[model samples]
Target: MNDQGQGITVVSLLLAGLLLYGGAGWLLDSWLGTRLFTPFGLILGSALSIYVIVKKMGGVKS
Candidate 1:
């Protein structure tokens, strides 16, 4: 795939992960006893999403 395709994939993943993290956090805080910090969820989700993208992008690119 070209650069644009790769970029789209990464952006899609980031957005999906963000929505998932936010919804999960909201549900957990609302229903479960465990209280998760909102910012923490975003940070972790973004980090995880980027990690996956970088790994899939073939690690350190020259």
Candidate 2:
């Protein structure tokens, strides 16, 4: 794929990660009556997404 396509894929993966995990966290907070999972989920999601993207991209070019 071209650079543009790869860029789009990366953005999509990041958004999906944030939304999916964040949503889960929100649900958990509502269910358990807590107030901390959302941020935690967002952070976790971001980290996991970065890890996946790096692996998929075969690590840094330089």
Candidate 3:
């Protein structure tokens, strides 16, 4: 795939991660009557997505 395609894929992955995790967090907050999980979930999702992207893009060759 070309660079543009790769860029699009990365963006999509990031957005999906944020939405999926953030939405889960929001649901949890609604269910449990808390207001912290949303941010936490978003952070976790972004971090995990970054990790996945790094691995997929081939980080640090030995």
Best by TM-score: 2
lDDT of 2 by residue, 1-62 (tens): 67898899899989988998988999999999998999999888888888888888865564
Indicate whether candidate 1 or candidate 3 has the larger TM-score. Answer: 3
After the best TM-score superposition of candidate 3, give how far the Cα of residue 59 lies from its true spot, in angstroms: 3.4
lDDT, ranked from best to worst: 3, 2, 1
Count: clashes, candidate 1: 0
Residues 1-62, candidate 1: write the lDDT tens digits.
Answer: 78999999999989977777766776777786666756667777787888888788966566
Best by lDDT: 3
Candidate 2 vs candidate 3, TM-score winner: 2
| TM-score, ranked from best to worst | 2, 3, 1
Error of 1 at 40 (Å): 2.1
Model 3: colliding residue pairs? none
What is the TM-score (0 to 1) of candidate 2?
0.89
Clashes of 2: 0
Q: Between candidates 1 and 2, which one is better according to TM-score?
A: 2
- True lDDT of residue 13, candidate 3: 84
Model 1 stretches astray by more than 4 angstroms: 33-35, 60-62
Mind giving the per-residue lDDT tens digits that candidate 3 earns over 1-62?
Answer: 66798698799889988999999999999999999999999999898888888877755554
Give all candidates' CA lDDT scores.
0.78, 0.88, 0.88
